[model samples]
Target: MTTTTPAALRAAAERFGDGEAVADGSVRLSWHDLLTAAETVARALIAEGLAPEDRVALCAPNTHHWVAAVLGAQYAGCVAVPVNTRFTEPEMAEILTRSRARALFVVGTFLGVDRLARLQGFLDGVTVIRIPGEGDRPSPDVIEWDALGAVAERVPVEVARARADAVTPDQVSDILFTSGTTGRSKGAMTAHRQALGVAAAWVECGEVTSADRYLIVNPFFHSFGYKAGILAALLSGATMVPQAVFDLDRTLELVERERITVLPGPPTIYQTMLDRPGKRPSTLRLAVTGAAPVPVVLVERMRSELSFQTVLTAYGLTEAVVVTMCRPGDAPETVSRTSGRAVAGFEVRIAGDTREILVRGPNVMLGYLDDPEATAQAVDGDGWLHTGDVGVLDADGYLTITDRLKDMYVCGGFNVYPAEVEQVLARLPGVSECAVVGVPHERLGEVGRAHIILAPGTSLSTEDVLAHCAERLANYKIPRSVEFRTELPRNATGKILKRMLRDG
Candidate 1:
């Protein structure tokens, strides 16, 4: 069995060989090519004197280099710390500092910004490897991506391969940082076995195969995009076509051009594709989405108009990816209403009183990196991970996420889950996206406030929103106030920054 990621790469190279592993723009690498590249990266790390389990950070987009760089770190028996590309300098610096990353693989430029230059002050003593990007210039003290081959020549290929073979399943493979919605982001440490376990489980549930081509629109930094997207493709032999940034036109073009068979993203991705100007024929077969409410109407539209045969909704956090996933051939209503039963060998049960979803599983994270107290609070003595989100499991084992525990607000002694309210608001015409947050109220202590992003060229009055909610929801459940915006603030993943909304 391929227990570690490096082992998986070797197995992939042996099995798939020349099969296309990654397709990023003009760059395409076969499985054998990918393995060779990763080995070269491992050799480079070895030459740099990075010890076993030492941290290396990759803060680039979902390009092929991001894929190769991370795999190379694993191949070298190093723990990869994937930094969010959307983070500000301070946030990036914090992660680099906290993770104690000895080397950094960052894009030279992205979206007219020099990401490395921006972090000049914080990158002291960190070995910087610059990946080619738009309008980038040569810099001192930074290793170019192509120059890794030369640095790697110092260490023999046999040495790197031996190091990769020695990596144990129990060793920490990667440290994935949380979105930090509540406070400081916690790095969730996942072992080689656990990471592969989740990917294999996702592969089983999604029915992924070697023939499938996966379009990875999700950011590589997030678990959904990294574990479920890149790693899943690696395990299943699916071709990974990464989209650095989500451009509607570019995504549609790639879907048609690449004959993309599997596309997984948040609900907004499908909705945006559905709302595109004209129908673009696609071969999209499987779509796994979550992170927010997926309306039944959207599911129906995705099947009917978007031509998706199987759409699965899944629920997971950074601690454990692929917790529950709706299986293939499930009814649209089933896919829309619930995130499917536990996969990845997870035992799921709702905590008695709080109704917080607790999971005990092989794929569950070992613990938060360097945060013992937080780790203790999250995982109990019984080995159940106390997922902070509130949810209910149905008779058939379907899991319905109600809301985050912190997002629930009491109105006149009545608890209102923002998800339920948001679901109702999603059905409203002209409502492109909506978020319900509890705001300070003098009498009720807390009242729901709706922040809406209207569909383009569409308009809705405060009364229009209130009247619609009044008809569907109870008086207390209705938002006391409504605010419209061009766009809602979201983190690296599509999850809304509810804390920001609440603060506003």
Candidate 2:
């Protein structure tokens, strides 16, 4: 369970050398292949002058190289900054600038690679390494990924040995950027101990084993993906299947083909898959959803249609990974109704008037990198990370997420949970996805408005949707108006971009 050091990967490589590590379509890498590739990339990075604690930005989609590059960076004693592949040039530029990254690795053919290419000028002093692609030649000043690995000398065992001697659990591992309701993104500096502790706790809570094959659909840029998906698999010696993007059909195929047992994703992903035409994988034993609220209807449909053994609802954030998880033994209704109790090694409490959820644990991020003022605001002097999510913990320890503190609204002296309203909208026929935000109101102080994406070939008028909500929810909880869109604005991890909705 102690996976604080990069040596854990070495351990896995030695123990499960012939076991599968990653599979992307026709390409598959066993533990031996993965370790060799990581070592090669690590040597290349070190040869390029990256030192211990240096920041290496990774902007690749989910691919074998993505995992390789991360493990390689860790092997070289460098901190990996996983960039959101969906970021605009300006956004990417801001993160690159903020992290003060010396090098950037990009997957070349994803939907937004061109946008990254457009920002090459913005990354003037930084080295840009492009993963190979067919239609495009390497841009000027950009180094080909394969070329770097070919010429770079392998890291001598002595170097790794020496660095390993000095590396400690408290050393910073990742700087994850989280955009809260206000201001620019803050870089949450997660330490090696914290990240590994989260992975350990997750492995324990989920009962993960070496026999499990995990399909990692969550973007590695986020802590949920890094600790929950990658590190958890590493600690348990489970095979990891990486998908750069979440395509419903392809995910289903991978699940069935790989005989994947453990699946972790947001509710949107599972909902999309249930709507797709396919047989659920027989080997899938546990289906877990988090990062957003799970609609009651979606949970019902997943169980009734997919026939998975259990559906678990989890809750966590960039600062603290896997804070709570509903156990498989919990009733299906309980799992569907709440985000579950606090996982091992974490304490959760509801705070102040709005009942914002606060967390304290070894898994909490060390602090925001180089921003003490922001860190002070986020983590109290006593060490709890203010999650900013409002919720209540029942006497029996069940944690029910009520709403995001920032997303709550007062409608004529009544508090309204936007998540509650959005959940209702999501259940309406033809609604594929939805986001709710509060807009200024003269009499009520604030009122809710919904931005919605309709399912393909389905449409509903604003009045119709509102009418449907009236049947299920109190009038104050219903959205005052609804806006239709082909797709809801989302961040890289498929989280609805409420800032856009608020700004609009």
Candidate 3:
């Protein structure tokens, strides 16, 4: 429990050796088994000529193999790059080329095989290791993941212990690519110490314990999923329940069946669960929502309707794992309205026009991978990460997010932020999800438009949505037009891609 270094796996192995570590449906592993798997994978990478500091890209879903490969790369002192599993072939190739990965661990499926084939030209000399399954076989040059285990001798326990202890907190742990809305994604290079720092802060603020059972619904590729969900659970000696894909029915059933104590995911997930038929479990202790903004109505429904013990909202980015979080004891209104106060060991401030949120702390990422200029631009010389978010802090210290600086549209001499309008639309009855974007206009330079997805069996017209928006929002902020879709385009992390709406 007194672990101070970045090697979280080592600490977990020593502290909770025989305890349940991870469970993915029928597949389960204890802390001891997890450690052994990681050690074996590490030795395999070393045997395959992978040197320290080399990049290992993991392109797979949230499976047991993905977790093993991540720990293995870290154990071998290599930087792990987790690619978004939902990315297209070209998109995956772009990330691989940018990271300049020495090797890639891919899932064995028709899509995975085809993606690898398309990436062959871009990969050039990079080695590809396929996770054995029903798929096209790779060339002789490519290696099978299972075969690697056969050739890789188990590293000595003493040597593995020593290597893990030698890893400093400042060493680069992973390069997580951000899902950018406007431009190409940037790889945020996070250090071991920084990641652990965020986990430690969460423990201090949220009071996580070893008895807690964390249900990990977020994709491991995202920072929130890795640090807040995985590392936090490991550090606290809690059992991690991973779901490869998010299904509302399965998630609720898991909570009831496993007696899951903690549920952490985006607001959409919580909303979906609320709409389901099952009632909240008596054992459910806390519900944490992050990654995207949550409407106050949803938080109120979770507490008043579902009777959850606690509903907490958080705000963070890949650069900083978690900067702000609403504690359980905080006012329900505060939890619903603001992103809560800054977590321990961090500072949040609004600068310039009082719309730009700035964060500074030890938990901040080192920089973007291979892009010093972009890094310099994001983190100023003063050490403040210019979070592109627009927010306001009340005199009582509650932080209320208004919009994103880049997402604001100038309409008829007034600024119309999409978040404000989207929040209004989200409040409409039968509206499942919505996104607002700026469209080109001849007179006002830009106009607001709303793309919405209604709940099943619910019907609404464009005029009805517009009327609902007009009642809650300003005239300028109201959507000039509305478009209904079966589903909104979302990234791997479930974040709606507003740019796609604009482009379409």
Candidate 4:
């Protein structure tokens, strides 16, 4: 048996043929139907003469068809590159050029902009395969999402099966680009075995099973959503319900209507649910949340008021899909405070002096695609991937991320990690969310300044926040000033845009 994603999909289909596999609003496909659709698209690629190992870019939102295209690429033995939906025209072109994607699977119109038009200059030598999203109409020079089956019907299905079977563990499965928060993004090439290991790890650590229903709100382009969210469901035989964008009311309705058992998202998702909580899903059994600081109170509420059987928090980067996950029976403090212990088959250690988190395991990427220097800088010569994020591995091996190396600043000879300060603020009364950045200070060279979000109808003065921090935190770690806002800005993945805060 192959360990690739396509192999997993076929196996799941055989076991759960009639069970729902993926749904995007109006369309919900069973495992067998979804697999058959993907295989049809795979054969279409072969009919069009797309060679094995060729690159195929999947640039779309969270749609069932997007899932089909990714599996199809795997069946065709082509490298699937998931492009960021939030990327601008230049960023999109850079990835298309960088990955050298021979074929492009793009959303027709997203956020009122034409994606195909967005890639006009970038399509100089690329084959465009358009997948129309809601409200999109037909145009020339693009293949319709459903038409691929009819076009590929001439090619025998066995040919696509043979191609999928020939895939090796070491071949590139996908090239995921980093968020490029610091600089230009580099494509992290993940092989079949590595990607499989990551997905399998999530299934085991997350305790996901066939009875679970996953509502995937994270964009499919993100590895968290692509590998851990989608592929993990395939591995566990869980039903997938894809949500393209996160609308609180709509999500609540979907959860209740579909009997969603497993829901994973960032802090924002839960915060919104807590604020509104339209209707508690009768089947909400588990919640695996990360990508932001989880206030201790939030975890308590999820397991109690939200009626989640288990609540878990995990930590990982794109280079490593899921490094650690809090276990099912962990205490609320453990789930909220730490990122849990390292997942099976991976080791986590803090650098000797810098305290930078280092990870080594089967899940680490092969390398940054076509960028040896960047690869060397990230993963050292000794095979340990030097994650730039600073963290502390407790005695029990539970890791608590303190801050990014780039985000740390020294104030009056004391180092201050923004996450540490932010956590202290998160516990403050009436605080919904907060961000801390080191601003230039003449006396100390730099001082921590906080931007805080207050809950609706709740008032928190800067004096109250500062006084609360003074009692709980050290002087150097405390923010020198505070600025209140309706909400903090976030990136596509729901991570706070600290750079934007600093720039402002």
Error of 2 at 48 (Å): 0.6
- Please report the candidate that would top TM-score against the real structure: 1
Indicate the TM-score of model 4. 0.81
Task: Give one digit per residue, the lDDT tens place, for model 2 in 2-59.
Answer: 5454777777888888888887778888888877777777777777777888898998
What CA RMSD would you report for each candidate? 10.4, 10.3, 10.6, 11.0
Instruction: Pull out the clashing pairs in model 3.
Output: none
Predicted structure with the largest lDDT when compared to the true one: 1
Minimal lDDT window, size 10, model 4: 408-417
What local distance difference test score does each model get? 0.88, 0.77, 0.76, 0.83
TM-score of 2: 0.80
Candidate 1 backbone collisions, by pair: none
Candidate 3, residue 233: the lDDT equals 74
Ranking by TM-score: 1, 4, 2, 3
lDDT of 1 by residue, 1-504 (tens): 578999999899888989999998899999999999999999999999888899999999899999999999999999999987766676688899999999999998897768899889888878889999898887878999999999999999999988998899999999998634334568999999999999999999999999999999888987888999878988999999999988989999999999999998877778778777797556989889876667899899888887888999998878998899999888989999999999989999999899999999898899998889889998999999988888899999999988676576655433466876788799899999999998876445578999999999899999999998876564667899999988898999888999899887
**Best to worst by lDDT, what's the order?**
1, 4, 2, 3
Ten-residue stretch with the least lDDT total in model 2? 408-417
Off by over 4 Å in 1: 179-182, 408-504
Steric overlap count per candidate: 0, 1, 0, 0
